[model samples]
Target: MNVELRYLRALVAVVDAETFTDAAIELGTSQAAVSRSIAALEQALGLRILQRTTRSFTPTPVGERIIAHARRVLDELALLERVAGDHGSELRVGYAWSALGRRTIALQRQWEELHPDVSLVWVQSNAPSGGLADGSADVAVRRRPLTEGRFTSTPIGAEARFAALAASDTLARRRVLRMADFAGRTIAVDRRTGTTSEELWPEESRPAGFRPVQGVDEWLTLISTGQALGMSSEATAAQNPRPGVAYRPVRDAPPIEVFLACWRDDPSPLVADFIRLARAAYLPG
Candidate 1:
Protein backbone atom coordinates (compact mmCIF):
# COMPACT_ATOMS: atom_id res chain seq x y z
CA MET A 1 0.00 0.00 0.00
CA ASN A 2 1.66 3.19 -1.23
CA VAL A 3 0.39 6.16 0.79
CA GLU A 4 1.77 9.59 0.11
CA LEU A 5 3.03 11.62 3.07
CA ARG A 6 0.65 14.41 2.08
CA TYR A 7 -2.34 12.11 2.43
CA LEU A 8 -1.21 10.87 5.85
CA ARG A 9 -0.58 14.43 6.97
CA ALA A 10 -4.02 15.50 5.78
CA LEU A 11 -5.67 12.60 7.58
CA VAL A 12 -3.87 13.58 10.78
CA ALA A 13 -4.94 17.21 10.42
CA VAL A 14 -8.59 16.29 9.86
CA VAL A 15 -8.58 13.95 12.82
CA ASP A 16 -7.00 16.59 15.06
CA ALA A 17 -9.30 19.40 13.94
CA GLU A 18 -12.49 17.31 14.03
CA THR A 19 -13.92 19.07 10.94
CA PHE A 20 -12.97 19.39 7.29
CA THR A 21 -13.11 23.21 7.36
CA ASP A 22 -10.85 23.35 10.44
CA ALA A 23 -8.46 20.83 8.92
CA ALA A 24 -8.34 22.76 5.65
CA ILE A 25 -7.60 26.01 7.49
CA GLU A 26 -4.82 24.34 9.49
CA LEU A 27 -3.23 22.89 6.33
CA GLY A 28 -3.52 26.18 4.41
CA THR A 29 -5.68 24.43 1.84
CA SER A 30 -9.32 24.45 0.79
CA GLN A 31 -11.98 22.19 2.27
CA ALA A 32 -12.49 20.52 -1.06
CA ALA A 33 -8.79 19.71 -1.24
CA VAL A 34 -8.78 18.22 2.24
CA SER A 35 -11.85 16.10 1.47
CA ARG A 36 -10.28 14.88 -1.75
CA SER A 37 -7.07 13.92 0.03
CA ILE A 38 -8.97 11.89 2.61
CA ALA A 39 -11.04 10.20 -0.07
CA ALA A 40 -7.97 9.27 -2.09
CA LEU A 41 -6.22 7.92 1.00
CA GLU A 42 -9.25 5.82 1.89
CA GLN A 43 -9.50 4.48 -1.66
CA ALA A 44 -5.85 3.50 -1.73
CA LEU A 45 -6.02 1.78 1.65
CA GLY A 46 -9.18 -0.14 0.62
CA LEU A 47 -10.52 0.59 4.13
CA ARG A 48 -12.50 3.38 5.69
CA ILE A 49 -10.34 5.44 8.00
CA LEU A 50 -12.99 7.82 9.26
CA GLN A 51 -16.67 7.75 10.05
CA ARG A 52 -17.98 11.06 8.81
CA THR A 53 -21.15 12.67 10.06
CA THR A 54 -22.55 16.17 9.79
CA ARG A 55 -20.99 17.23 13.09
CA SER A 56 -17.51 15.63 13.12
CA PHE A 57 -15.18 12.94 11.80
CA THR A 58 -14.55 9.85 13.92
CA PRO A 59 -11.66 7.55 13.23
CA THR A 60 -12.55 3.96 12.40
CA PRO A 61 -10.71 1.06 14.03
CA VAL A 62 -8.28 0.80 11.14
CA GLY A 63 -7.75 4.56 11.14
CA GLU A 64 -7.03 4.56 14.85
CA ARG A 65 -4.38 1.88 14.30
CA ILE A 66 -2.92 3.84 11.40
CA ILE A 67 -2.84 7.03 13.47
CA ALA A 68 -0.56 5.48 16.11
CA HIS A 69 1.96 4.46 13.43
CA ALA A 70 1.52 7.72 11.57
CA ARG A 71 2.32 9.75 14.69
CA ARG A 72 5.56 7.85 15.24
CA VAL A 73 6.56 8.19 11.58
CA LEU A 74 5.72 11.90 11.56
CA ASP A 75 7.62 12.54 14.80
CA GLU A 76 10.71 10.81 13.44
CA LEU A 77 10.50 12.91 10.30
CA ALA A 78 10.18 16.12 12.36
CA LEU A 79 13.19 15.09 14.52
CA LEU A 80 15.27 14.64 11.37
CA GLU A 81 14.31 18.10 10.15
CA ARG A 82 15.12 19.63 13.54
CA VAL A 83 18.52 17.93 13.60
CA ALA A 84 19.25 19.23 10.12
CA GLY A 85 18.50 22.77 11.25
CA ASP A 86 18.93 24.64 14.53
CA HIS A 87 17.78 22.31 17.33
CA GLY A 88 18.03 25.05 19.97
CA SER A 89 15.68 27.56 18.43
CA GLU A 90 12.52 29.19 19.84
CA LEU A 91 9.64 27.11 21.14
CA ARG A 92 6.25 28.72 20.54
CA VAL A 93 3.55 28.12 23.15
CA GLY A 94 -0.14 29.07 23.07
CA TYR A 95 -2.66 29.57 25.84
CA ALA A 96 -6.24 30.71 26.19
CA TRP A 97 -6.93 33.94 28.06
CA SER A 98 -8.11 32.03 31.13
CA ALA A 99 -4.82 30.11 31.39
CA LEU A 100 -2.66 33.08 32.45
CA GLY A 101 -2.47 31.88 36.01
CA ARG A 102 0.35 31.50 38.51
CA ARG A 103 0.55 27.78 37.84
CA THR A 104 0.96 28.29 34.09
CA ILE A 105 3.51 31.06 34.55
CA ALA A 106 5.50 29.04 37.03
CA LEU A 107 5.51 26.05 34.72
CA GLN A 108 6.74 28.10 31.79
CA ARG A 109 9.56 29.58 33.85
CA GLN A 110 10.56 26.14 35.10
CA TRP A 111 10.55 24.72 31.58
CA GLU A 112 12.68 27.59 30.30
CA GLU A 113 15.18 27.17 33.11
CA LEU A 114 15.41 23.43 32.46
CA HIS A 115 15.87 23.92 28.71
CA PRO A 116 17.81 27.18 28.36
CA ASP A 117 18.56 26.37 24.73
CA VAL A 118 14.88 26.75 23.83
CA SER A 119 13.48 30.27 23.67
CA LEU A 120 9.79 30.34 24.64
CA VAL A 121 7.35 32.51 22.74
CA TRP A 122 3.93 32.76 24.36
CA VAL A 123 0.74 33.50 22.43
CA GLN A 124 -2.52 34.27 24.20
CA SER A 125 -5.92 33.61 22.64
CA ASN A 126 -9.52 33.53 23.79
CA ALA A 127 -10.11 30.25 22.02
CA PRO A 128 -8.17 27.63 20.04
CA SER A 129 -10.03 28.53 16.86
CA GLY A 130 -6.99 29.56 14.75
CA GLY A 131 -3.99 28.99 16.99
CA LEU A 132 -3.23 25.44 15.89
CA ALA A 133 -4.84 25.94 12.47
CA ASP A 134 -2.35 28.67 11.60
CA GLY A 135 0.66 26.70 12.86
CA SER A 136 1.61 29.65 15.01
CA ALA A 137 1.57 27.62 18.22
CA ASP A 138 3.29 24.38 19.09
CA VAL A 139 1.29 23.60 22.25
CA ALA A 140 -1.98 24.93 23.68
CA VAL A 141 -3.32 25.21 27.21
CA ARG A 142 -7.12 25.06 27.25
CA ARG A 143 -9.77 24.86 29.94
CA ARG A 144 -11.63 22.17 28.04
CA PRO A 145 -10.47 18.91 26.56
CA LEU A 146 -10.04 18.42 22.79
CA THR A 147 -12.96 16.08 22.15
CA GLU A 148 -12.13 15.69 18.45
CA GLY A 149 -9.48 13.08 19.30
CA ARG A 150 -7.05 14.72 16.89
CA PHE A 151 -5.07 16.21 19.76
CA THR A 152 -3.46 14.27 22.53
CA SER A 153 -4.66 15.81 25.81
CA THR A 154 -3.21 15.65 29.28
CA PRO A 155 -5.53 16.51 32.17
CA ILE A 156 -3.82 19.23 34.19
CA GLY A 157 -6.16 20.65 36.81
CA ALA A 158 -9.69 21.80 37.54
CA GLU A 159 -11.09 25.27 38.22
CA ALA A 160 -14.26 25.97 40.14
CA ARG A 161 -16.50 28.84 39.08
CA PHE A 162 -16.96 31.74 41.48
CA ALA A 163 -19.38 34.63 41.64
CA ALA A 164 -17.30 37.79 41.42
CA LEU A 165 -18.96 40.86 42.84
CA ALA A 166 -18.03 44.46 43.49
CA ALA A 167 -17.26 45.30 47.11
CA SER A 168 -20.35 47.53 47.25
CA ASP A 169 -22.64 44.73 46.08
CA THR A 170 -24.79 43.12 48.74
CA LEU A 171 -23.69 39.64 47.63
CA ALA A 172 -20.12 40.45 48.52
CA ARG A 173 -20.93 40.02 52.21
CA ARG A 174 -22.12 36.47 51.74
CA ARG A 175 -19.87 33.66 52.98
CA VAL A 176 -21.21 31.28 50.35
CA LEU A 177 -23.33 31.84 47.25
CA ARG A 178 -26.12 29.89 45.60
CA MET A 179 -27.95 30.07 42.26
CA ALA A 180 -30.92 31.86 43.78
CA ASP A 181 -28.63 34.65 44.99
CA PHE A 182 -28.21 35.78 41.40
CA ALA A 183 -31.93 35.81 40.61
CA GLY A 184 -33.12 39.06 39.06
CA ARG A 185 -29.56 40.38 39.33
CA THR A 186 -27.64 41.32 36.18
CA ILE A 187 -24.90 38.74 35.70
CA ALA A 188 -22.05 39.14 33.26
CA VAL A 189 -20.63 36.23 31.26
CA ASP A 190 -18.55 35.52 28.18
CA ARG A 191 -20.71 35.34 25.08
CA ARG A 192 -20.88 32.05 23.25
CA THR A 193 -19.93 31.68 19.60
CA GLY A 194 -21.13 28.36 18.18
CA THR A 195 -21.77 26.57 21.47
CA THR A 196 -24.29 27.80 24.00
CA SER A 197 -23.47 28.52 27.65
CA GLU A 198 -26.37 26.30 28.57
CA GLU A 199 -24.42 23.36 27.23
CA LEU A 200 -21.41 24.34 29.31
CA TRP A 201 -23.50 24.86 32.46
CA PRO A 202 -25.07 22.05 34.36
CA GLU A 203 -28.80 21.77 33.68
CA GLU A 204 -29.89 21.95 37.30
CA SER A 205 -27.07 24.15 38.50
CA ARG A 206 -27.53 27.12 36.20
CA PRO A 207 -28.01 30.46 37.85
CA ALA A 208 -31.38 32.07 37.29
CA GLY A 209 -31.41 35.34 35.32
CA PHE A 210 -27.78 34.87 34.29
CA ARG A 211 -26.85 36.83 31.17
CA PRO A 212 -23.71 36.80 29.04
CA VAL A 213 -21.65 39.87 28.17
CA GLN A 214 -19.64 40.48 25.01
CA GLY A 215 -16.27 39.40 26.40
CA VAL A 216 -14.30 38.51 29.51
CA ASP A 217 -12.85 41.98 30.02
CA GLU A 218 -16.27 43.55 29.76
CA TRP A 219 -17.63 41.09 32.27
CA LEU A 220 -14.81 41.84 34.69
CA THR A 221 -15.20 45.54 34.23
CA LEU A 222 -18.93 45.38 34.91
CA ILE A 223 -18.44 43.38 38.07
CA SER A 224 -15.63 45.56 39.29
CA THR A 225 -17.66 48.75 38.85
CA GLY A 226 -20.72 47.47 40.70
CA GLN A 227 -22.82 47.39 37.55
CA ALA A 228 -23.21 43.60 37.62
CA LEU A 229 -22.02 40.39 39.19
CA GLY A 230 -20.01 37.99 37.03
CA MET A 231 -18.83 34.42 36.92
CA SER A 232 -15.12 33.71 36.71
CA SER A 233 -12.79 30.82 37.20
CA GLU A 234 -10.92 30.47 40.48
CA ALA A 235 -7.69 30.88 38.57
CA THR A 236 -8.89 34.16 37.06
CA ALA A 237 -9.99 35.54 40.38
CA ALA A 238 -6.72 34.46 41.97
CA GLN A 239 -4.67 36.21 39.31
CA ASN A 240 -6.64 39.46 39.09
CA PRO A 241 -8.40 39.93 42.36
CA ARG A 242 -9.01 43.63 42.34
CA PRO A 243 -9.66 45.58 45.55
CA GLY A 244 -13.22 46.36 44.47
CA VAL A 245 -13.98 42.82 43.43
CA ALA A 246 -14.47 39.81 45.69
CA TYR A 247 -14.71 36.16 44.68
CA ARG A 248 -17.21 33.96 46.47
CA PRO A 249 -17.34 30.24 45.78
CA VAL A 250 -20.39 29.09 43.88
CA ARG A 251 -22.25 26.26 45.49
CA ASP A 252 -23.58 23.43 43.33
CA ALA A 253 -21.79 24.58 40.21
CA PRO A 254 -19.91 22.77 37.50
CA PRO A 255 -16.14 23.18 37.37
CA ILE A 256 -14.20 23.39 34.14
CA GLU A 257 -11.31 20.96 33.76
CA VAL A 258 -8.01 22.18 32.34
CA PHE A 259 -5.99 20.23 29.77
CA LEU A 260 -2.76 20.56 27.86
CA ALA A 261 -3.53 19.70 24.24
CA CYS A 262 -1.18 19.14 21.30
CA TRP A 263 -1.74 18.11 17.69
CA ARG A 264 -1.81 14.33 17.95
CA ASP A 265 -0.56 13.89 14.41
CA ASP A 266 2.18 16.53 14.59
CA PRO A 267 5.52 15.40 15.92
CA SER A 268 7.06 18.31 17.84
CA PRO A 269 9.39 17.65 20.76
CA LEU A 270 8.78 21.07 22.23
CA VAL A 271 5.07 20.37 22.53
CA ALA A 272 5.80 17.08 24.31
CA ASP A 273 8.12 18.77 26.79
CA PHE A 274 5.57 21.49 27.55
CA ILE A 275 2.88 18.91 28.15
CA ARG A 276 5.16 17.07 30.56
CA LEU A 277 5.90 20.26 32.50
CA ALA A 278 2.21 21.21 32.62
CA ARG A 279 1.23 17.84 34.04
CA ALA A 280 3.94 18.03 36.65
CA ALA A 281 3.04 21.57 37.67
CA TYR A 282 -0.76 21.41 37.76
CA LEU A 283 -1.81 17.79 38.14
CA PRO A 284 -2.56 16.87 41.76
CA GLY A 285 -0.07 14.67 43.56
Candidate 2:
Protein backbone atom coordinates (compact mmCIF):
# COMPACT_ATOMS: atom_id res chain seq x y z
CA MET A 1 0.00 0.00 0.00
CA ASN A 2 2.88 2.38 0.77
CA VAL A 3 5.49 1.12 -1.65
CA GLU A 4 8.34 3.37 -2.78
CA LEU A 5 10.36 3.27 -5.98
CA ARG A 6 13.67 3.09 -4.10
CA TYR A 7 12.57 -0.03 -2.22
CA LEU A 8 11.48 -1.69 -5.44
CA ARG A 9 14.78 -0.75 -7.10
CA ALA A 10 16.74 -2.30 -4.23
CA LEU A 11 14.77 -5.57 -4.45
CA VAL A 12 15.42 -5.76 -8.20
CA ALA A 13 19.11 -4.91 -7.81
CA VAL A 14 19.60 -7.57 -5.15
CA VAL A 15 17.80 -10.21 -7.21
CA ASP A 16 19.75 -9.41 -10.37
CA ALA A 17 23.17 -9.17 -8.67
CA GLU A 18 22.57 -12.09 -6.25
CA THR A 19 23.84 -10.20 -3.20
CA PHE A 20 23.19 -7.04 -1.16
CA THR A 21 26.85 -6.06 -1.44
CA ASP A 22 26.78 -6.24 -5.25
CA ALA A 23 23.42 -4.47 -5.43
CA ALA A 24 24.71 -1.65 -3.25
CA ILE A 25 27.76 -1.35 -5.46
CA GLU A 26 25.58 -1.23 -8.56
CA LEU A 27 23.24 1.32 -6.92
CA GLY A 28 26.17 3.49 -5.72
CA THR A 29 25.09 3.12 -2.10
CA SER A 30 26.20 1.32 1.06
CA GLN A 31 25.36 -2.37 1.49
CA ALA A 32 23.46 -1.62 4.71
CA ALA A 33 21.16 0.84 2.88
CA VAL A 34 20.40 -1.72 0.15
CA SER A 35 19.59 -4.42 2.74
CA ARG A 36 17.31 -2.08 4.66
CA SER A 37 15.48 -0.99 1.50
CA ILE A 38 14.75 -4.59 0.57
CA ALA A 39 13.54 -5.38 4.06
CA ALA A 40 11.30 -2.32 4.04
CA LEU A 41 9.89 -3.33 0.64
CA GLU A 42 9.14 -6.84 1.88
CA GLN A 43 7.46 -5.44 5.00
CA ALA A 44 5.36 -2.98 2.96
CA LEU A 45 4.24 -5.67 0.53
CA GLY A 46 3.74 -8.27 3.28
CA LEU A 47 5.55 -10.77 1.10
CA ARG A 48 9.06 -12.17 0.83
CA ILE A 49 10.45 -11.36 -2.59
CA LEU A 50 13.73 -13.27 -2.51
CA GLN A 51 14.91 -16.68 -1.38
CA ARG A 52 18.39 -16.14 0.02
CA THR A 53 21.07 -18.61 1.09
CA THR A 54 24.46 -17.95 2.71
CA ARG A 55 26.09 -17.50 -0.69
CA SER A 56 23.28 -16.69 -3.23
CA PHE A 57 19.69 -15.55 -3.71
CA THR A 58 16.87 -15.75 -6.25
CA PRO A 59 13.44 -14.14 -6.73
CA THR A 60 10.46 -16.00 -5.37
CA PRO A 61 7.52 -16.75 -7.71
CA VAL A 62 5.56 -13.68 -6.61
CA GLY A 63 8.75 -11.60 -6.54
CA GLU A 64 9.32 -12.21 -10.23
CA ARG A 65 5.95 -10.67 -11.10
CA ILE A 66 6.50 -7.71 -8.75
CA ILE A 67 9.99 -7.15 -10.13
CA ALA A 68 8.64 -7.11 -13.68
CA HIS A 69 6.13 -4.40 -12.72
CA ALA A 70 8.91 -2.44 -11.03
CA ARG A 71 11.05 -2.58 -14.15
CA ARG A 72 8.16 -1.11 -16.20
CA VAL A 73 7.64 1.65 -13.65
CA LEU A 74 11.32 2.53 -13.75
CA ASP A 75 11.36 2.49 -17.52
CA GLU A 76 8.44 4.92 -17.63
CA LEU A 77 10.15 7.18 -15.12
CA ALA A 78 13.24 7.29 -17.30
CA LEU A 79 11.13 8.19 -20.33
CA LEU A 80 9.44 11.00 -18.37
CA GLU A 81 12.82 12.39 -17.38
CA ARG A 82 14.10 12.30 -20.95
CA VAL A 83 11.04 14.10 -22.28
CA ALA A 84 11.01 16.72 -19.54
CA GLY A 85 14.75 17.39 -19.93
CA ASP A 86 14.31 18.34 -23.60
CA HIS A 87 11.47 20.81 -22.99
CA GLY A 88 13.70 23.84 -22.56
CA SER A 89 14.14 24.82 -26.23
CA GLU A 90 11.99 22.44 -28.21
CA LEU A 91 8.27 22.19 -28.92
CA ARG A 92 7.57 18.52 -29.56
CA VAL A 93 4.33 17.80 -31.38
CA GLY A 94 3.07 14.24 -31.63
CA TYR A 95 0.95 12.47 -34.22
CA ALA A 96 -0.35 8.95 -34.57
CA TRP A 97 0.31 8.42 -38.28
CA SER A 98 0.76 10.91 -41.09
CA ALA A 99 1.23 14.38 -39.67
CA LEU A 100 -0.39 17.20 -41.64
CA GLY A 101 0.07 15.72 -45.12
CA ARG A 102 1.36 18.33 -47.61
CA ARG A 103 1.06 21.05 -44.99
CA THR A 104 3.69 19.55 -42.65
CA ILE A 105 6.63 21.22 -44.41
CA ALA A 106 4.88 24.53 -44.70
CA LEU A 107 4.03 24.54 -41.00
CA GLN A 108 7.56 23.66 -39.98
CA ARG A 109 9.07 26.31 -42.23
CA GLN A 110 6.66 28.94 -40.95
CA TRP A 111 7.37 28.02 -37.32
CA GLU A 112 11.11 28.19 -37.94
CA GLU A 113 10.75 31.60 -39.54
CA LEU A 114 8.60 32.93 -36.72
CA HIS A 115 10.45 31.36 -33.80
CA PRO A 116 14.01 30.61 -34.84
CA ASP A 117 15.07 30.03 -31.25
CA VAL A 118 12.65 27.15 -30.65
CA SER A 119 12.93 23.90 -32.53
CA LEU A 120 9.64 22.49 -33.76
CA VAL A 121 9.88 18.73 -33.48
CA TRP A 122 7.29 16.25 -34.68
CA VAL A 123 7.11 12.84 -33.00
CA GLN A 124 5.14 10.00 -34.56
CA SER A 125 3.78 7.51 -32.05
CA ASN A 126 1.40 4.56 -32.48
CA ALA A 127 -0.36 5.03 -29.16
CA PRO A 128 -3.91 6.41 -29.13
CA SER A 129 -2.75 9.36 -27.02
CA GLY A 130 -0.13 10.16 -29.67
CA GLY A 131 2.56 10.24 -26.92
CA LEU A 132 0.93 13.01 -24.86
CA ALA A 133 0.02 10.71 -21.96
CA ASP A 134 3.55 9.28 -21.86
CA GLY A 135 5.22 12.76 -21.69
CA SER A 136 6.86 12.24 -25.08
CA ALA A 137 5.13 15.32 -26.49
CA ASP A 138 3.81 18.67 -25.34
CA VAL A 139 0.86 18.49 -27.75
CA ALA A 140 -0.72 15.96 -30.09
CA VAL A 141 -2.70 15.97 -33.33
CA ARG A 142 -5.30 13.21 -33.21
CA ARG A 143 -8.06 12.07 -35.55
CA ARG A 144 -10.31 10.79 -32.77
CA PRO A 145 -11.75 12.37 -29.65
CA LEU A 146 -10.04 11.65 -26.33
CA THR A 147 -12.56 11.03 -23.55
CA GLU A 148 -10.16 11.41 -20.65
CA GLY A 149 -10.86 14.49 -18.52
CA ARG A 150 -7.15 15.10 -17.94
CA PHE A 151 -6.75 16.29 -21.55
CA THR A 152 -8.33 19.13 -23.47
CA SER A 153 -8.92 19.02 -27.23
CA THR A 154 -10.20 21.35 -29.92
CA PRO A 155 -11.22 20.47 -33.47
CA ILE A 156 -8.79 21.77 -36.06
CA GLY A 157 -10.12 20.31 -39.31
CA ALA A 158 -11.22 17.13 -41.07
CA GLU A 159 -9.70 14.90 -43.73
CA ALA A 160 -11.47 12.87 -46.36
CA ARG A 161 -11.18 9.07 -46.14
CA PHE A 162 -9.19 7.12 -48.72
CA ALA A 163 -9.11 3.41 -49.43
CA ALA A 164 -5.75 1.63 -49.65
CA LEU A 165 -5.53 -1.38 -51.93
CA ALA A 166 -2.96 -3.51 -53.73
CA ALA A 167 -1.98 -2.23 -57.18
CA SER A 168 -3.11 -5.44 -58.79
CA ASP A 169 -6.50 -5.50 -57.12
CA THR A 170 -9.49 -4.95 -59.35
CA LEU A 171 -10.67 -2.07 -57.22
CA ALA A 172 -7.46 -0.16 -57.94
CA ARG A 173 -8.66 0.57 -61.47
CA ARG A 174 -11.49 2.70 -60.14
CA ARG A 175 -11.01 6.44 -59.94
CA VAL A 176 -12.82 6.40 -56.58
CA LEU A 177 -14.27 3.92 -54.08
CA ARG A 178 -17.20 3.60 -51.68
CA MET A 179 -17.49 2.03 -48.27
CA ALA A 180 -19.78 -0.73 -49.57
CA ASP A 181 -17.37 -1.69 -52.38
CA PHE A 182 -15.20 -3.80 -50.09
CA ALA A 183 -17.98 -5.31 -47.99
CA GLY A 184 -16.95 -8.86 -48.86
CA ARG A 185 -13.18 -8.33 -48.56
CA THR A 186 -10.96 -8.42 -45.53
CA ILE A 187 -9.81 -5.08 -44.11
CA ALA A 188 -6.61 -4.23 -42.26
CA VAL A 189 -7.20 -1.91 -39.28
CA ASP A 190 -5.05 -0.31 -36.60
CA ARG A 191 -7.49 -0.29 -33.71
CA ARG A 192 -5.43 1.98 -31.46
CA THR A 193 -4.24 4.86 -33.63
CA GLY A 194 -6.07 4.42 -36.93
CA THR A 195 -9.09 6.30 -38.16
CA THR A 196 -10.63 3.32 -39.93
CA SER A 197 -13.23 1.08 -38.34
CA GLU A 198 -16.30 -1.03 -39.20
CA GLU A 199 -18.47 1.82 -38.04
CA LEU A 200 -17.38 3.79 -41.08
CA TRP A 201 -19.64 1.60 -43.14
CA PRO A 202 -23.25 0.65 -42.64
CA GLU A 203 -23.56 -2.46 -40.49
CA GLU A 204 -25.06 -4.37 -43.41
CA SER A 205 -22.06 -3.54 -45.60
CA ARG A 206 -19.21 -4.12 -43.19
CA PRO A 207 -16.04 -5.88 -44.35
CA ALA A 208 -16.04 -9.66 -44.33
CA GLY A 209 -13.21 -9.72 -41.76
CA PHE A 210 -10.73 -7.44 -40.02
CA ARG A 211 -6.97 -7.94 -39.74
CA PRO A 212 -5.29 -6.13 -36.84
CA VAL A 213 -2.17 -4.03 -37.32
CA GLN A 214 -0.04 -1.70 -35.16
CA GLY A 215 1.31 1.01 -37.44
CA VAL A 216 1.03 2.62 -40.87
CA ASP A 217 3.86 0.56 -42.39
CA GLU A 218 2.31 -2.69 -41.22
CA TRP A 219 -1.10 -1.62 -42.55
CA LEU A 220 0.44 -0.72 -45.90
CA THR A 221 2.45 -3.95 -46.05
CA LEU A 222 -0.65 -6.03 -45.37
CA ILE A 223 -2.56 -4.23 -48.10
CA SER A 224 0.30 -4.43 -50.60
CA THR A 225 0.41 -8.20 -50.24
CA GLY A 226 -3.20 -8.26 -51.53
CA GLN A 227 -4.20 -9.96 -48.28
CA ALA A 228 -6.40 -7.11 -47.01
CA LEU A 229 -7.57 -3.60 -47.74
CA GLY A 230 -7.32 -0.48 -45.52
CA MET A 231 -8.92 2.91 -45.07
CA SER A 232 -7.33 6.06 -43.69
CA SER A 233 -7.31 9.82 -43.94
CA GLU A 234 -6.08 11.51 -47.14
CA ALA A 235 -3.00 12.60 -45.21
CA THR A 236 -1.70 9.02 -45.07
CA ALA A 237 -2.17 8.65 -48.83
CA ALA A 238 -0.20 11.82 -49.51
CA GLN A 239 2.60 11.11 -46.97
CA ASN A 240 3.05 7.36 -47.55
CA PRO A 241 3.12 6.16 -51.14
CA ARG A 242 3.99 2.48 -51.44
CA PRO A 243 4.89 1.16 -54.88
CA GLY A 244 2.58 -1.81 -54.59
CA VAL A 245 -0.33 0.09 -53.06
CA ALA A 246 -2.82 2.50 -54.58
CA TYR A 247 -4.96 5.00 -52.71
CA ARG A 248 -8.44 5.82 -53.95
CA PRO A 249 -10.83 8.35 -52.54
CA VAL A 250 -13.68 6.80 -50.60
CA ARG A 251 -16.47 9.03 -51.80
CA ASP A 252 -19.13 7.98 -49.32
CA ALA A 253 -17.21 7.44 -46.14
CA PRO A 254 -17.44 10.34 -43.69
CA PRO A 255 -14.40 12.51 -43.28
CA ILE A 256 -12.19 12.03 -40.21
CA GLU A 257 -12.19 14.92 -37.73
CA VAL A 258 -8.85 16.21 -36.52
CA PHE A 259 -8.22 17.54 -33.03
CA LEU A 260 -5.30 19.26 -31.30
CA ALA A 261 -4.83 18.16 -27.69
CA CYS A 262 -2.68 18.95 -24.67
CA TRP A 263 -2.61 18.29 -20.95
CA ARG A 264 -5.53 20.07 -19.31
CA ASP A 265 -3.56 21.01 -16.21
CA ASP A 266 -0.23 21.89 -17.82
CA PRO A 267 -0.65 22.97 -21.44
CA SER A 268 2.36 24.29 -23.32
CA PRO A 269 2.60 28.05 -23.84
CA LEU A 270 3.02 27.39 -27.58
CA VAL A 271 -0.13 25.29 -27.92
CA ALA A 272 -2.29 28.23 -29.02
CA ASP A 273 0.15 29.27 -31.72
CA PHE A 274 0.52 25.66 -32.91
CA ILE A 275 -3.25 25.26 -33.05
CA ARG A 276 -3.60 28.47 -35.04
CA LEU A 277 -0.99 27.30 -37.54
CA ALA A 278 -2.60 23.87 -37.82
CA ARG A 279 -6.03 25.37 -38.46
CA ALA A 280 -4.57 27.60 -41.15
CA ALA A 281 -2.83 24.65 -42.78
CA TYR A 282 -6.06 22.70 -42.88
CA LEU A 283 -8.02 25.63 -44.26
CA PRO A 284 -8.78 25.78 -47.97
CA GLY A 285 -6.38 28.13 -49.70
lDDT of 2 by residue, 1-285 (tens): 789888877776676556786566446588999888988988999998888888777888998998889866855674565447446678889897888887899999999987788898999876556766556677888999877676788899999999999999999999999888989999999876789887777888888999988789899999999999999999999999999999999999899999988767554557778888899888887
Where does candidate 2 stray beyond 4 Å?
Answer: 1-87
Q: In candidate 1, which residue ranges exceed 4 Å CA deviation?
A: 1-88, 148-150, 191-196, 199-210
Counted clashes in each candidate structure: 1, 0
Question: Which residue window of length 10 is worst by lDDT in model 1?
Answer: 191-200
Error of 2 at 129 (Å): 1.1
TM-score of 1: 0.62
TM for every model, in the order presented, reads: 0.62, 0.73
Clashing residue pairs for model 1: 16-150
Per-candidate Cα lDDT values, in order, are 0.69, 0.83
lDDT against true structure, model 2 = 0.83
In candidate 2, residue 223 scores what lDDT?
Answer: 94
